[model samples]
Target: MDAASVPAPASPGPATAPPGDLAIWFFILAELLAFGVFFAAYAFARAHNVALFDTMQQTLDRQAGALNTVLLISGSACVARAVEAVGRARSATGARWLLAGIACGAGFLVVKGVEYAAKFEAGINLSTNTFYMFYLSLTFFHFMHVILGMVILVALWVKTRQGAYGPADMNGIESGAAYWHMVDLVWIVLFPLVYVMR
Candidate 1:
């Protein structure tokens, strides 16, 4: 064949970038740093009041904390599935997964709310001691993140149901999923530190 008639070898596709927007990753890093500082404060406080922390830890609703753990972890898994589905252009399936993830996050909030109610009923407050202070502040901080994460998931679900996300346009859903995973991760660490640690 004439060289001019032969096709050139196919060029490889462009390299894949990270799943989400660069801005979202930077936001995630900042959020993680804030959580890290909070965690370190908890650890430092606990070290100086080991006996008090241990005693107070015993009074916590271990079952409730454990349940919230399950709920958050399940939520994270559902979000992951949602992202995967969206990447495959299966918007309906992605919406379903996002809804499931939202439900899981809501369950966590409900369980944690009940736990807080009980604590307040028993007159527990930040003034209760160093332990309750850290427990309430740390967990509540995480609680707000969960709420924000759920909000992001809800938005993603709405857009996904409208066929907004797909392989060609994944930045929004991926960014929201990244933040939701961060919320789940902080809870995983908080549960052990504030609920079960000695």
Candidate 2:
């Protein structure tokens, strides 16, 4: 066969696979549904006790929440950059960007820990009041998700260093970055709902 007459096979990638593992979308959807229910409950509770929600909301550290918001946003952007680098087969650059993203996620955890510590020191617990119940419960739930996302990111970073991803092959990295973006998106909704909304 003439070289010019030979047809090239289609390269399966994000455009074909929806970015990442097909299975992860199930997990992401389940997680999102859970968060949606929680958010609905929060709205219900707030509706029933507007004054209490508003008062307790004030006790929360808006500054810390805001800081975490910025970190997650930045982290998500870095993950995107990392994905792009990986697509280009720039393993070193991709790994570096992933590390930066992981750092941002870790920073969020630290800021959240301090905020929780202060709450605990003040003797605030789920039983403290209704508003506190939702405040702590919701944030803690999202906090756990952040931790899980970081774990995923670290694995992706390691894989990137090993030359496991590229434009022709990126399911693993795409899936991990997708999950991390979900984590960030939830927080974007959460911060406004729990802190900024009255």
Candidate 3:
């Protein structure tokens, strides 16, 4: 063998990091902190006005709340499956899972609309009392989050279809999923407090 035939060792430079993961984590942490404050306020108010809160809770339809809970929980499960599919290098499968998740979210919104209509017809507007005020405010805030989550899920589905998300670059999908889960988590607390914890 000639000296020219000897192979040179590869040199290393700065390592490249995955996109969006750190930013997503930071965003999630900030959102959690804000939600934590809201939850604390909710608990304080409920404790201070237990009798009124109980009266308000009694007016809500527990069955409807339970249905919404199941819907959100199913959506969260679909999101988890989508994450798994992405991890396994199945972008199409992940997209399908995302679509399912989005559908579940839409279903939750539809049910909520029915619940709201019933409440409105029953003279349970936001100004009715403190309980109704909290009910409208909290559920409306959550509904906004649901809309945002649906947008994110649709974006993720589109990206997945376009071959954007995969095992190597799934941070966006994961972040979106995490945000949806947070929304669901908030409702888990809110449903009981606003509708059942009398």
Candidate 4:
């Protein structure tokens, strides 16, 4: 068929990333690197003082950490569902899932705050010991990430309501979801490494 007679192709629906923005990926990579350095330092310190780590680990509130683990995982799952919903052009449904995710993340923050309050009440701080320095620092850092992720999700939720996300234009929502998953993953690793290790 002549070019004039042939029809142009239709683009595929659903976006996989921030279509035109490479900056977010760079930001994500930088964030991951910062966390990676922290984790590596933790491992090094743990290796040099296994006894200290074990004794301190025993003092952690495993129940709270465990609960937070479940909460973050559930939140991640909800975000995943939201991505799927958005993929199907179900913006409202996706926003609903994001709301659920925000709730889960909030639950995590509350539980974590309680845990921190108890620690503070008991006079715990970064100067308490090397283990606690790592504990408070790691967890609090992750806590901040959750807060930031929630903010992103909230923005995405607002955008979705404005019909900004869909299979054909998913970059913003997907990027936000990706960040949330990364936050969840870090907690998954942090919880076990800090709370349950012996």
Candidate 5:
């Protein structure tokens, strides 16, 4: 082998951190902790009121919960594709994917709104029962998160349309995406826990 013909070994690249700002990760951890506390409280309360919790869980519209699950999953997929597209410098395509994600998030809100309306119409409220109290509070908390996530998505879409995100510039969009994903992940757990757990 000719030494002159041999290529030098490639240098190792810088270590990659989690996508987005460190601040965003801290915020996400805080949000997760809050949700964890809520979940633990629900579990503790249910343990003592197993029969009421089980019966009230059955009264929940499982189909609506399932539909919202699909919507959140689909929205998360769209957001992931948008991030990929932006990484490739396909701003137009990225914006389109973000739009789709926003639509899915909107659909989730609409479905949940309908469910809430029905419950309200049937005279359900926080004072209705122990089950209703937790159900309303927990689901409403998650609903607010979804709203905030959608707002972030809309901002990301606008920036993407203006070509703000790319391989060299991903922090803003990535931070927003990370937050959106947290919202979806919480719902994924909530859906099964509140609707299906027996």
Candidate 6:
């Protein structure tokens, strides 16, 4: 066949990331740095005004914070199970795990919302004082991360339904799970600093 007369083979579809191999590390790193800065600020403020900070801590509901910490830690466990399910090529089971993790994360947020409402009603606005400012800023920023983690779980769940994850490749799921763990880790530090630092 003449070169000009021969048909060009169809171009391949856009390259896709292998399941669980998405470039998510950079995102996780950036998020960690941002939270780190917030943590540093919190530490500095607490160090400067130890008495006031302790007084502020006394006003918070440590029980609720501790319960939320448990929820997040449990959610991390579910994500681990989901990653295992993906490695076993059980996409449906993986989806179930991811969904359960997402539900736990949601529960954490709901509890946080209740805490916020209670604080708000008690006139614990950010403008109340430096300690309240740090408390609101740190917890609210953490809340935003929780929302992001939920979104990631939903995406992973959809990808699982689409059969994108399997035994051969579970990087996407693993990366998402790692990110969730980072969220949990941040809260672990935050809980002690904000609720138990007296």
lDDT of 5 by residue, 1-198 (tens): 655886765876764479999899999999999999998899899999999999999889999999999999999999999999999999999999999999999999999999999999999999999989999999999999999999999999999999988998999999999999999999988998999998
Candidates' lDDT values, in order? 0.92, 0.94, 0.85, 0.88, 0.95, 0.89
**Model 4 alpha-carbon drift over 4 Å, by segment:** 1-21
Model 2 agreement with the true structure over 1-198: per-residue lDDT tens digits: 654796655774454447888999999999999999999999999999999999999999999999999999999999999999999989899999999999999999999999999999999999999999999999999999999999999999998999989988888999999999999999999999998998
Q: For each of the candidates, give the backbone clash count.
A: 0, 0, 0, 2, 0, 3
> RMSD in angstroms, all models?
5.5, 4.0, 6.8, 4.6, 5.7, 7.6
Better-scoring candidate (lDDT), 1 or 3:
1
RMSD after Cα superposition, model 3: 6.8
TM-score for model 3?
A: 0.86
Q: Across residues 9-126, which tens digit of lDDT does each residue of candidate 1 receive?
A: 5886764456799898889899999999999999998899899889889999999999999999999999999999988989999999999999999999999999999999999999
Tell me the tens digit of each residue's lDDT in model 4 across 42-141: 9899999999999989888999999999999999999999999999999999999999999999999999999999999999999999999999998899
TM-score to true structure, per model: 0.91, 0.92, 0.86, 0.88, 0.93, 0.87
Residue 52 shift from truth in candidate 5, angstroms: 0.4
Compared with the true structure, what per-residue lDDT tens digits does model 6 show for residues 41-153? 98898899999998878989989999999999999999999999889888899899989999999999999999999999997788999999989988999999999999999
The best candidate in terms of lDDT: 5
The TM-score, computed over Cα atoms with residue i paired to residue i, of candidate 2 is 0.92
Cα RMSD (Å) between model 6 and the true structure? 7.6
Q: List ranges where model 5 is wrong by over 4 Å.
A: 1-16
Instruction: Find the 10 residues in a row with the least total lDDT in model 6.
Output: 14-23
- Which candidate leads in TM-score? 5
Of 1 and 6, the candidate ranking higher by lDDT:
1
